[model samples]
Target: MNPAEAGPQVERRNATAACVEFVQALLERKVVEAVLVPQHVPGAKVVVQTLVTDPSRLEDVDPVAPVLMSNSATMVSSLSFQAPKGRIAAVMRPCEINALVELVKFKQANLDDVIVIGIDCPGTYEPKDYMQIITAHGGPISEQVFESLSRGETPSFDGYELREACRICEHPSPANCQILMALWGADFSSGPVIVPVDEKGREAVDKAGFQSGNLPAHRQQILEKITSERSARGQKILEQFAQRIGSIEGLVDEFAACKKCMNCRAECPICYCRECIFCSPTFVHESNKYLKWARQRKIIKMPVETLLFHLTRLNHMVTSCVGCGQCSSACPNGLPVMELFRTIGSTVQRIFDYVPGRSLEEEPPFTTFREDELEPR
Candidate 1:
């Protein structure tokens, strides 16, 4: 059966409240052992993912919150990498689902006992920026965002904007998930339209007791419009960035302020190495080695291999970069790491005809090789 045809619209007035009720139903009905979802932190304006086993604990749940503290893919990877005894459902944004899909291919996560509940994301703010926006509005702004989506318009705050990664993200709608809480072109006042994407999703919807119905008439039309705008914006921005870093000197200059803090790797969901080469003894050069290099060049950056670090990361996972932009948010020096990765990843992924997080059946380009592949290069 086609999963999209089995649309289950949640019957509620407020979109956010509707999503919360649906998640609560999952717990109350025992659809899964636990649900990993975002909730508001008490006494603060922050939102973070929380694993809930009790339905009553869902009072603060806000699955569509317009802020991303970190990519939840890493969290899902940790929980499902070994296949837990009980099934777990993760509510994640489109990018998080994509990143987790890549991790699954790398043997970093197993989805057998995991049910993915993906959400259609318009965009999100950096953690700090989200706090400010919330304060400026004097409260949570998810409802406002949903209202904007219902009108087929991008959500905009007075003085803030979405992160660059989100602005250029072409995949606003999620794929490869068991279930989806669709928002684009939705009638939020009537509640979010939930679509079951697979057998697992259909079963979950049944267990949760949502009646199957037709999807919103214009959801696809609105999604295509959003994707098109983002793709065009991404192309323009990345093209200019590519030209800016065309030369080795230009690339070096762009990363000249790198502190080598490794924050980018720490935030990257695709960089699943338990012990990265950067953290290994391989990069811990002897004192005399630094002195020797300084003498040879008469000058050198204090943290050697800063450029090498970025390059090595690109080589390792650029093919699987989901463009979540957490790396740029993690940078203390405010470097354009996301732009660099997206620009380079666009080229590399195209060369291999791979889109990270697109599917679980397709092997990553790095994992498989064709005898004639790249022979012309």
Candidate 2:
């Protein structure tokens, strides 16, 4: 029987239920040895990534939760380093999927033994903001909002909303992942449809006996609308950033509030390094040097190299940045770190004609060398 014709028989009651059943089927069929998913911790308002080997343990799985405590791509990278024994399914956001693709090109993640399952993400709240919303709701995140999203409705709780990065994200759908859990344009009353985007996903779906269907026609329309809106918003955001800190002096003044704690680097998904040069002894200077600088300038910033640290990070990660905004979310000083990276990184990526995480076939500009690519000054 045709999969689309059989959709009614296999249609799930809700998106969450459909996701749980699909993942459970994958585990039961042994298509993958384990699945990495988001699990809502009991008695806690937080959702975190959990590796599940047992299908029965998926009862608390909520991949659609609006909480982004950490980038899942970095978690996948952590797993990839160990070279796990069997195929592992990773459910991730579109941004996280892109970050994973970039990591694979950087050799920080291995794709041979993994399957990436991406979901249509509208956006998510910062960890703290999500907690506040949950507290106010007197429950876990609202299924009403999650379901409304599938129907193209925007649900808000007072002034609460998605993070800035998510708001301006132009790529809301999956491009690099193997499987895409389609949410938009699907009637939540019938559940989301899972479409395989690659051979790996197709094989897994066939093995798991998932009933598939064509993407809804309205899905394209919805996606295009979202893309247009986000692209415009992204451009406006870049313009505002340029106006605020386009000059060297303006940039210095904006970042002058930096405490030099390196929290942004710590939280960034692309800033992968065992030992950063910023933390090296080379940046450390003798007492006389500090005194000499203070005497020469009458007074100097206490935690020196604040601008240098940002510049070094920008140089190291601009080409690979996926604009996940974890850096800004991690900043203790509320600096507009994400705005700076997205603005400058977008320009750098354009200069190289590269899009981070667009595909595995495209090599990272930093790692590739073509002497004729850039003209000598």
Candidate 3:
């Protein structure tokens, strides 16, 4: 379902400042033990995730910091694992929120103790694209890139900064969360902008002393303008990568440089295996085995069992991929891990007529099956 079409309608404006205040209020009200948001380091404008135990830290709350290298989903899971059993309210973009939901379903996380603050993602730049923008803009970053220029109806980098997967994402606004930060006002247009996705989110806003205002039509127009442009870019990407998605051979070829680094699995929010079979000695071969392969095939695939390795993983968790893109980020060889997994994940999830992370009660595809399904004599 379209994110915009599913929620209670309301108005919003100048939410950037309101959001910061809301986080501070959550801290004061003890709604969360800490507020997980990004902050600007004094010397460098590079915004990193900061766990705010005190409301004062919200002064640096910059939700717009571009996150491509790290997945906020993984961050949340790791924090949940390591931190005390207190409610941790985290500010996340749409994809991060969805990833966390999927993680909860996989038993890798618990959402009962967390307050999610979701934002309307305009999109982000790839790692290099962001660096390039910083370099060209004379170091550090200004609010102008995401806060202003984009609202002016022009992306700062002509699609250079957007990750491959985000360009195709049809759902830019968040549909599920305890709180959806309204960005309806403070932009070019005059109309109603923000509203709650559910009763829980609405209550949070109300508790923060926020009453609904007119959501600006210009804000939606801004979103649509970006969406249309990204759609064109997404179509270009599909055509460019079409052949690669055709078969396993194409998929494998795309990973030709993969060294089985397992970084993808490591950074994945949903990968909860304390001990993975691929990481086990079951797949490890001695030097003799590598030499033996060289003798048999003249040249061995350096990683060994690369295709089998990935397929084994695909068999296990392809249906639960939330497309956080951390796998692609962790790939040292620059494999389009997100593209391959999402392509396969979409197909896998569809088999069970499911959308990963949409709801908690839904069982995974492999966890259940119809008795008469797929019967062929």
Strongest candidate by lDDT: 1
TM-score per candidate, chains pooled: 0.95, 0.93, 0.82
Q: After superposition, how far is residue 50 of candidate 1 from its true place, in Å?
A: 0.5
Clashes of each: 0, 0, 12
> On lDDT, who's better, 1 or 3?
1
Predict model 3's lDDT versus the native: 0.67
Tens digit of per-residue lDDT, candidate 2, span 1-377:
54222221212237577788989999999999999999777667778899999998887777777778888898899888668789899999988998998888888899888989898887888888887777666655536555766767545677787888988988878788888888878776767779998898899999999966578668888888888898899999889998889888899888988999999999888988988898789988987999999999999998888998999899988998998898989999989999999998988999889999887889888888786767772
Model 2 misplaced regions, further than 4 Å? 1-13
**Per-candidate local distance difference test:** 0.88, 0.83, 0.67
Residues 1-377 of candidate 3 have per-residue lDDT tens digits of 43223321111233245666677887887767898887644444356788889887666566754545566777787777544678888888878887777777666776667778877675667666665665555543434434553353434554465666777765566656776654423453322134556676676667656665554546667667667776676566655575665877787788788888899888776777889998788877787988888999998777788777677777888888877777777778888877777767766788788887787788878767777777572
Which runs of model 3 end up more than 4 angstroms from their true locations? 1-16, 81-84, 138-142, 145-154, 184-194, 212-214, 218-236, 239-242, 245-249
- For TM-score, the strongest prediction is 1
> For model 1, how does the per-residue alpha-carbon lDDT over 24-60 read when each residue is reduced to its tens digit?
8888899898999998786577899999999888777
Residue ranges of candidate 1 with Cα displaced over 4 Å: 1-13
Cα lDDT for residue 113, candidate 1: 88
